[model samples]
Every structure is written in structure tokens, then in C-alpha cells.
Target chain A: MTKKTKWFANGYLTLVFVLLYVPIFYLIMYSFSTGKTMSHYQGFTWAHYVALFQDARMIQIALDTLLLALLSALIATAIGSLGALGIYATKKRQTRNALLSLNNILMVSPDVIIGASFLIFFTFLGIGLGFGSVLMSHIAFEIPIVVLMVLPRLQEMSTTMIDAAEDLGASSWQVLSRVILPAIIPGILAGYFMAFTYSLDDFAVTFFVTGNGFETLSIEIYARARQGIDLEVNALSGILFVFALLLVVGYYLLTQYTAKRQKAGVKRP
Target chain B: MKRKQVLFEMPYFFWLAFFVIAPILLIAYQSFFNIRGQFTLGNYATYFTSATYLRMTLNSVWYAFLITLFTLLISYPTAYFLHYTKHKQLWLLLIILPTWINLLLKAYAFIGIFSQDGSVNQFLTFIGIGPQQILFTDASFLFVATYIQIPFMILPIFNAIEDLQPSYINASRDLGANNWQTFTRIIFPMTMSGVKAGVQAVFIPSLSLFMLTRLIGGNRVITLGTAIEEHFLVTMNWGMGSTIGVVLIIAMFIIMSLTGEHKKKGRKHND
Candidate 1:
């Protein structure tokens, strides 16, 4: 890390971040523009935000998105932890590899392919198009992400910790509750949060499976974007953008603090 | 040994058998015989024989290939540059910031970027470049998809390159290998797995890209994804869509196996 190389890397990093965020920044900027003629600048006002708040459709869609994310993420997280347990318990290499492969399918498969297949699967099961079906599809995809995040934690988990708890007279459920859950809770939390975020934002499979009547925020965004975007939606997106940024900042600070503490502490083991 | 094998395998295989393999097996069965009304290979035959479906599958494949290439080209440099950064944690966050934003938001953001008087055209005007009002076409669709999926390509590559010991490069250079040769021979080969995984990550979604195609490509892009959507939704033709789904699954399985083989060879070479 010489001075010249340091400067070069830092400069490039700056450019990359700029590219990453510039569009969202522009969207935020346009939210306040008073003129309908889209331009770089205009008289600034909170009129758009005010209008956005009053829009019932946007609010309904946001609620729908939240509801879907909460339900799907909970189910996915439970199944994922269980799947991880089953995976970890399996000692044969071939069996473990096959399970891992199957779990990772959603991460690899093309969304359209999965969506189309799921549609067929559900239709075959005699399920009608509606909320229940949408929930099933969301769970199908969300479970894989949960399995991905939690499985690593399970693998890295100290076997002695679980053994110690069981030796202390904890039953299987008690062991899971008292030690295993606590041990990998951070990873599970991360998985659940990521799942919620994904389910909130997903459009592809949701697009395929969602019934005609129900709409999520992603669907709203799609519909708004398609029918020509309005500044009101721009303002709403800005508000969400700001909220997401704040949450990310908080998480970063929290992680950095823990990392620093971990660096400072004596070895707990 | 037999009992040990059974105990070791039962849970993992059971889950797969019931949850994953069963569904796929069902799909495979249904693909051959229409779910509700008929029983035959007519669905598969129709899709295979249709000139339109063949062209669309190729279009989807090539779209994915080009996107993979573009993502690798841009991401490798960015990741390479970031590898040398001191403030990596924050910088890494920035590299993956697009991923944190909702995918749909990012997709919509591109529309804002490439709209007629969008940011791109506005910048072009300021710089005295070509025509005004540029958006919504095959090119923009590809561009938007690339923009959305670039982070997927960068993360694994960055993480892998970060793990590479600097001593290897220094060793190569000390042995009088030039920078270009050292990078190609030592650096690239060592990092091939990450690159392959990243390429797969970027390419698969891009291959099945339907939302962006419909939105940005104005439904004219006619990808395999769009075709699936059209079949299952508009025309209510599940049989054709299922047939295409089987083809897609087979193609991906082939890619996975080939990559697995490449991975094995790479490991052996290193050994």
C-alpha cells in the first residue's frame, strides 16, 4: 500500500460508489422538482411528498409488501434452520452435497423458470390463484436464502457448546432453545432480515404468482413506472430510500463496533 | 458400513426427496403429459419445432452470455482496484450498495437514467454528443439488466482476490515475469472459481430476465422468460411453458456440470 497505489485505489473506489448511487440520488433530487417538465433543477417544494402520503394506493401497496415479507420470512427462517439442522446431522458427503445443491437451486435458477414451474406445481395441486398461492411461491424462494445464511452459522457452530448443554440435562428442544438458537442467532437474524428485504422487493416470481386483485409495493412500482412515473411516486421512493439508508448506516455502525470490540477482547474460548 | 450409510443419508435425502426432488419429478412427469387435459409429447414437440421458440431460447442464451461478459469486464477492474483500498469495509459496502436497494427500485432507477430526457441524455446534451431522447429498446434493456446484476459479479471476485496472498504476485515478478504475464498466469488462474461463480450468478438471472425485458425492452425483447410468462399467463398454455421450463432446467444442469468439471480440473492443476 504505497502512496501512489493507495490514491489510485481510493479514487477508483470513489468512482464506483458514485456510479452505484448516482441514479438513486437523481431520483431523490427529482422528487422535489416543482415543474412537470423533468430537468436537473426546479423550484423545490415538499408538495410531492405531501401528495404521495395522501395516495391510498401507494400506502395499500406498501402494507401489502410488508405483510408478504413478514409472513414469508418467518416461515422461511423456521424451515431454513430446520433444514440446516438436517443437513448438519447428515454425515455422508454425498447426501450432504445433494442437500446443499437442492437448497441452492433458487439462488441459481432463472426466476421465470422457477415461477413458471411453481405455477404449474400449484395448478397441479389444485390451488387457485390468490394470496395462499402467492405466499407459497414467496416461501419457496425465501427458504433458500435463509438456508444459505443459517447453514454457514450452523457449520461454524461449536459442537461442544451444544454437547455441553445436552450434558447439563437439556433435551433436544431445550438445547435448541437455550444454546443452538442463541449461538447462531446473529446469522439467523441476518438471514431473516435479508429474507424480509428480498420478499419486500421481489417482483419476478411474485409477478407470476400474485392473483389479479392483490398488489405489492413492487407491483405498484412496476405499474407506476410503466404508466409513466409521477413525482409523487418519486417522493415516496425518496422517503423509502432515506429510511433504507438510515437502517444500513445503523447496521454498519453496529457491526463496526462489534468488530472493534472483538478485536480488543481477550479470547472468550 | 451399510447402517452407517443409511443413518448418514436419511435426513438430507429425505428432505430433498420430499421437498425438492419430488416437485421436480412431478414437473418432469407433467411436462411429458399435460397436467389437466391431455397426455403426450405434443407440448415438447411444439416448442422444439416452433421457429419462434428456438430463436427466443438462443436470444435468451446470448443475452445472458453478453451480460456475463460485460459484468465481468467492469466488475473485475472495480474489484481489483478495491482490493488495493485501505478503507475496504465502507468501500465494499459502496460496491454492493446497489444490491441493498430493492431490485425493483434499481430497475425503475434505470428507467429514470435512460429516459428520453433521462440523466444519460441530459449528460450527453451537456457534453455535445448525439441525439436527444434515448430509452426503451433492446440496448437499454441489456444496459438496465447489466446495471442491476453487476454487484452480483463483483462481490465474489472481490472476496476471492482479497484472499490471494501478495507474495504470489511478488514471487512471480521476482522470477522476472512481467505484470501482464503474472496477472494472466498467476492471478487469473488462482481466481478462476470466483470468476466462474460470479459469471454464473450474473448470467442466470439475466437469462431469465422478464421484468426488465417487458418494462425496458417494451415487450419486444421476447426472451425465454417473456415466452414463459406469455404462455402461462396470457395464452394459458401451461404445457408449452412447462416444456420450456424443462429445457431451461436441462440447460442449467449442463452448465452446472461443466462448471463442476472445470472446478475439478482447476483444483487438480493447483495440486
Candidate 2:
């Protein structure tokens, strides 16, 4: 491209990046302000962070959110990986496609629809709306994503390896544990990570199902935000910003490491 | 072996039945019931006949359209230009990083920026316009919604652009076509799938940004999502909410069908 256009493109990209990052940084920046509102930065102080740490309710909710994400992601990964495996092993294309579409219903449905429907589903089943309801909903919504993530890896695997394992007298369980699982471990991890993030980031579904007694961080922020500006939320955002950054970095590194290892394995063989 | 495999897959099947299929059927069934628990088609009747509900649906679609339009306009060029940049993957990751932050926190951030004494107001005041009420306005809502959706739009389009073969552009140039002509005839047409995917990603969610309407729109802008939330949570009208949920699902399907990849036709095999 010409220098003028190149400059223009660079400028445009810089502008878009600024727009994207400004809000996030603005929130994080105000977390240090001694002022009560985000509008004014009266001076820098760690008071909001200190308050965030000391607020017992907020701390408990954060821990609960973490626990919920971990448990849901774990269960979803196991079930979803097996679902992907089953889909792969299906001889009929129609059954496989039907299953795939069924799996994606939750992925495409708007969160409100999912939340409303799940609320109805829970109430109909006589399931009380609380931790149990929230956990189940998270697992439900998370499974589809986990399936999507792992299915591609399953497809990429060579079927001959499974046949070879069977010919060597490996049981189905042995084949799964020793042959298939190791090959798709990266996809499984990726699915688990995605599920964890989805559960953590989810608001609407959790909001609809969560009883008055239980609130995730998103619901709490929503409640607090409606009341007006609170720097404690900003403090939480600052910490979350760091946490999300670490997660992305870690995920990126993990994927890169796996890719390198795969290349090395291929080269050796 | 077959039995073992079926047993292994049992949980997934159970999940499919209980979570996916059952909730959908339950929602559809619930839509037939009125608020007082009587089984009737009144909720659908109310949604279809009521002027207020009709107007709200139209407004919600319009706002979502606007958000999608603006997001596309901004993101297309960003993605197009981003393709030529060094370290584009890293740049794309940076684009995606904001999304990882809790959406509520981002919305909360805008509350501060657009508030009376927020940065935008301060800029306005500096420009001699003085501080106007930027928050809770249609403009602020549109801006934030578009902002939130930009990364999603960009990612798909960038992938599409990256997927474009350089040979096509070079061939177009060799055939005496200029840059604009080449882009319109070759690059843009090839990237249509990505644009469709981007729209699919942005438009559906845009229709149901209930939290945005409440926090940024100041209840001035009521989307389908806001209505559903109000019905389910505030008014305790699960029936009406489910009716709206069904409508959203239908809308989702319509969009999916419209944007979904159509199979290529009429290609003859050379024997």
C-alpha cells in the first residue's frame, strides 16, 4: 500500500483499538481513585481494592462463582468430550448431523430465551432455584461449547489408531483411556477453558435461575451498577482485567506449547 | 462394545433430552398459559394484537439493525486493514481481550464515561457545547452496543480476508483491473461468507441486550430482552416472557436461514 494509505490504515486501527481499550482502562484507572464516582478522579488511592478485599459478601460471591465455573466446566468437558466421540463414531450421517444440531441449540439461542426456558424447566421439574439450579444451568449451557471445541480435534484424529488398539486386544475402556484421550487432550483442555470462561462470564442465564440467596459476580455487578456508580465494582474490574489477561496469556502459551510438541512428535515419527 | 459405548454416551443423550429439548418444549408449552396459570393462547394473542408489544418488537429489531449496521461499517475496514498489519494475530488477540472482561464491567465503565461529568461531557464542555445529557440517550446506547459488538464482527471478517488468495488480486491486477475494481469484483465477493457469519454473531445478541437498555438506555430503549426480563422478573408474567422468548427463537432461526451457507450448485464434474 501507499504510505498515505498505510498511515490512514494505521491511524484507523489505532482509533479502533483505543475505543475498545478505553472503557476497560477507564474502569481500571478509576479503581485507584479516592473519589466515590468514576466521573471524577480526585486522587489515587488503594481504598477500593482494600474495600473489595474486605467486603465479605463480595469475596464469598467471587469464590462461589469460581467454584461454580470449575465444577460446571469439569462435568461439561467429560460429557461433551464423550458426546463428540459418540458423534464421531456414528455410522449414519443423518444421525450425526441431527445430534450436532441438537447440541448447538443452546449455543445459538439468545441468553434470555435460555434463561426463561430454563426457569420454566426448573420450576416444572420442581427443582428449587438456587445453587443446584445455577450449577445445572451452567453445565447445560457450557456442554455445547465444549462439544464444539472437542469435535474438531476428534475429526482430526486418525481412525486407524483406534482400530490398531482394538486389534491389539485393548478393551474399549483401554482404547479410550490410552489411545483416544491422549490424542485429544489439547482439545479437551481448550473445551474446559472455554466452559470455565463461559460460566464465569455468563450473566443472563445465571440471573434468571439464581435465587435471591445466591448471586454470582455478574449479577452482583448488575445490581450494584443499577444503584449508580460504585468504585468497588471498578476495583473488581481491575482485578478481573488482570485475571482475564493472565487467562488469555496462559491459554495462548498452552496452545503454542502443544502445537510445538505435536510438530516434534510428527517429526520424530 | 456397542453397549459400552452407548453407556458412555448416555449422559450426553440425557443432557440433550433434559436441557436442550425439554426446555424448548417447556417454553413453548408455557407460552400457552396466561399469568394466572390458566391454559390459553392469550399470551400469543396479546403479543400479536397489542400495539405496545408490536411497537416494542419493531423498535428492538430496528435498534439491533442499527447496531449491526454500524458495527459492520466500522469492523469491515478495521478487519481489512488489520490483515496487512504485522503481528496481526497479536492484534486480533488484543481485539478479543476486552471481550474476556465481564460485559457488565464494560457497561459499568460506560456509565462513568457518559455520565454528566464523564469524559465525553468534559470533552463536550471543552468544545464550548457544554455538558449535555449524553447518557440514557439513543446515541449512547447505539455507540456502546456497537462498541461491544465490534470485536466479534472484526474477527470473522479478518479471517475471511486472510483466507483470500493473493493470486486472485494479482490476477485481477494483471488483467488491468484497478484496486477498487479488484476489491469489489474479487475480494469483497469472496469475503461475503465472513460478513454473513459476522452478522449472525452480532445481530442475534444485539436484539437481547437487556442490561444495556436498563443501564445505558435508562429504560428509554426497550428491546425484546428487556421486555422478557421485565415480564419474567418484575411483572411475574412467565407466560408472556415465554411468548417473547419463542418470538426471539423464531427470529434467530430466520436470521440463521438467511445467513446460513447455501450448498454450491450446478458444478459439472470433468470425467
Candidate 3:
């Protein structure tokens, strides 16, 4: 906690950051290394990025990934937020425990098992595994994660705001829209981002649920990876890395800002 | 929101039932059938009797244990750095951005860097040391596993450390507690749940991971996931695949239950 120690902490933090990013930096550098060898930096070129753009299937797969991620996030967020509200509204102890336990199963269980199970489940029920089924399977696993993320904020929400609105002749619907919605918006947004990231990098469940002739970006990456480090895929991955970084950075800032504001309020009072 | 919400969700539930639920149930049912299609534990017996299957299960368990252990070791210092630093806002972006890279890509990147004439070897040769073929070895498999699981360990521990009240640590130190004493007695105990949660988060996924083995382990390291993939995808042996998958699930459930019980006991003792 001294000045010297704080400076030491600076060095420590920098080292941690380097360890985290060196692998990624290595990837980006070698991605443009102008070699079919996939290693050994021969020279520099932008051919990989160009090749990535020209591959017609890359656009389709990108669209598939976005559509799947967005649809899954929307459904999972709805189920999770509503379920959290229901828990808030009812406040039944046994119901709460049961819901939480179920949520944990959905959240923490092995993705491979869940994916495998769903694959078999669909085949047994004669459901055709396709892009649509992939989205649904994504939701089954994701809704619980959303609930876990959002429920704590809902529980902490003050009832006074809702009652205050109702006391002024506002309907229940009006109270929900005018009071509840605004309060939970940040938490809901956080849940949405979590769902989006989870769905974006997802493979296990997607592997199980994805059917004949349908490929998302991750699955396509898997097929390419089997052959070797194709530089074009590296460029594509770099782009995804940037996008996910933005979402995570946004989530971290919003959460920290809220926490800091709360601490400031506590100090004042 | 409503327009898209209802259009997407109504049929989606039905879609989940057929795709997600039914396949899981079918896998469960397959574990009980015989060649005659009569109900029995025949599949389970066949799987258990095969020594190769037993060894594969053990391999999966041991490999996952190593990944979780090593991931925690690497992540602890990183998580500790995040905990004590003020620049956590930017530092976390560095830590988490790599996690977004496709797992396969990371595995491939390792191959790119560690292959016989790869980057690491070339760099080593630039120094005094001779070249070593570290790729496709057990060490590489361990590296790949740890790399994938580190984020899981880091996030849970970091969250716990963030939520930690500074007052308790300060109070303990004020009472003449040394650095080690304060950390072990106060900090570690409080973060025990986070550590446990971290273990579960990393352990479960690492336990079931087969794809990394496939891509990077190069057909040498066989985990339960690889076995299941083979049974289901390669041989079309649904019955055997379900049996293996079921056993893996049961083992995971037991491990999770034990962790849950330990945490409850810890909380009770604290109370």
C-alpha cells in the first residue's frame, strides 16, 4: 500500500496483461506473415484479410452466427428476466430454491453432455436439426444464465418506487413501464451481453444441435482448425476478438460505474 | 420487442422440446436397451467390463484434475493482481479478450507456435538451447487444456475478490496480523467459495473437453469426450455412446454435489 509497493503493483499488473495478450498478439502477427507454412514469419502481407473477405461462405456463416446469437439472446433474456421478476413478486422460499437449483443445472452442467443430450433428444422426437433448432437449443441452456445474472439486481430493487407510482393513480402496467423497467434496464442489458458472448463462442451445444449443411462461424472455424492454422481464419478470429472485447469492456465499465456511485452514496449518508 | 419476441419464442419452445429434450431422453433410454431391443443394463455391463473404457474414464478424470489444478495456479496470481490493482478496468480487458478467441483457434495457434520448426523452437534456437519437438506431447495437451480453462477460474475468483469488503482485511492487519496471516485467515476463507466455484467452472468443462484433444492432442490423448464422439459419430454405436456419456454425467454430478455440500458446511461453520 506504500508508494514503492504501489509502483511494484504497476509492474505486476503489466506482467499479467502481457501474459494474457501475448498469445493473441502472436496470432495477429503471424496471420499476416506471408507464408503457407503457418509459422516462421517470412514477410508481411494483407492477403489473408483479403482472402477472408472473398470467401463467399464466410458471409453466410457470419449471418448464421449473428442470427443465432441474437435470437437466442432475445428469448433467453425474456425467460430469465421474467423468471427473476416472478421470483421477486412471489418471494416463496421453496420456489426460489427450486428455481435456483434448476438454474444452476442449466448454467453449470457440462456443455458436451447438454449438447449430446439435445442432439439425441431431437433425433428421437424427429425434429430436424437446422439453424432454427440451433437457436432453440442455445436458449434452453442460456435462459438460466440470464436468470442468474439478472435475479440478484431484481431482488435488490426497492418496492417503494413501484408503490409510489401506484399511489399516484398509475395502473400496474404503468408502474411496470414507468418504474420497474427503468431500474432493471442496466441489469437486463448486462444479461443480454452475457447471452450474446456465450452464444457467439459456443460450440458444444451448437455441435449437437447443428444439422446437415448448416454451419455457424465457430463450427466453420472448427473444420478449418482441423487442417491447420489457415491465416484467413486467423484474420476472421481477430475481428471476433475485437468485437467480444468491446462487449466485455462495456459490461465491466457499466458495472464498475454503478458500484462506484453506490459507494459514493453510502459515504455521503 | 414484442413482435419479434412472440414470433421467435412461441415455436421456439416447441422447437426446444423436440431438439433438446427428446435427444437427451433418447440417450438415457438407449443406455437401457439390448440387441433384441429389450430393456436391460446390458450396455452398462458391456462398457464397464472393457478395461479400455475404464482407462479412458480414468484418463478423463485425471486430465481434468490436472487442468483445473494448473489453471487455478496460473489464474490465482492473475486474479490476485486484478484484486489489488487500481487499473483493473483496463487490465481485465486484456485478460478477457483472449477468451473470446475461438477455442479451436487457440489450439491451432499453439500448433503454430510449438510445432517442430515453430516460433517457440526457433526462438529457443536463437538462444543457446537446441530444438525440441514439444508439440503433440502430453505437455502440449496440458497447455491447451489449461489455456482454455483459465478464464473460467479467473472470472469467478475475480468476482469474489471484487465483492470482498476491505474492512475485514484492514481490521485483521490492525490487530497485528502479518501479511500471510491476514491472507490465509481472512482473505482465503472468504474467497473459499469463489475458489470452489472456480474449480467447478473449470473442472466440469475440462473434464468433458474432447475437441482440444482432437485438434491439438493429435489423436494421442483420448478423453471421454473423444470416446463419445467416436461412438456417436464414428461407429454409429449409439448404445455404447450413451452409456459412456451417462457415466461421465454421473461422475460430474457427484463431484458437483460434493463441492456444494462442502460450501454449505463451510458457511454453517462460519455462522
Which candidate number maximizes DockQ? 2
For all candidates, state DockQ relative to the true structure.
0.42, 0.89, 0.42
- Runs of candidate 1 with Cα error greater than 4 angstroms are A1-11, A165-169, A253-266, B1-19, B33-36, B125-133, B262-271
Q: Which candidate do you rate higher for TM-score, 1 or 3?
A: 1
Q: Supply candidate 3's per-residue lDDT for B259.
A: 65
lDDT of 1 by residue, A44-163 (tens): 999998888888887887887789889988987777767776777778978888878888877788887767767767777788877887887787777778778888878877899888
The numbered model that scores best in lDDT is 2
lDDT of 2 by residue, B1-271 (tens): 8998999999999999999999999989999999899999999989999999999999999999999999999999999999999998889889999989999998999999999999999999999999999899999999999999999999999999999999999999999999899989999998988999899999999999999999999999999999999999999999999899899989999988887753222122321
TM-score of each: 0.90, 0.98, 0.89
The true-versus-predicted C-alpha distance at residue B240 of model 1, in Å, is: 1.0
Which whole-number lDDT from 0 to 100 does residue B223 have in model 2? 97
Instruction: List runs of model 3 lying over 4 Å from the truth.
Output: A1-13, A166-169, A252-269, B1-26, B34-38, B266-271
User: In CAPRI terms, where does candidate 1 land?
Assistant: acceptable
- For candidate 2, give the lDDT of residue A182: 86
In terms of lDDT, model 2 sits at 0.93
Q: Output the lDDT of residue B39, model 1.
A: 87
lDDT of 3 by residue, A1-269 (tens): 77886787678667766665677777778768788766767898988889988988898899888988898999888877776666566457777676566556657667777877777777766789897779877877777677677777777778887778978999766876788776777778788878887888888778877887788887888888887768888788677777777776777788888777656856995
Tens-digit lDDT string for candidate 1 (B150-261): 8898898988898898999999999999878998999988887788888778776776787788778888787777877887788887777777778888878877776567
Question: In candidate 3, how many Å is residue B262 off?
Answer: 4.8
- Model 2 earns a TM-score of 0.98
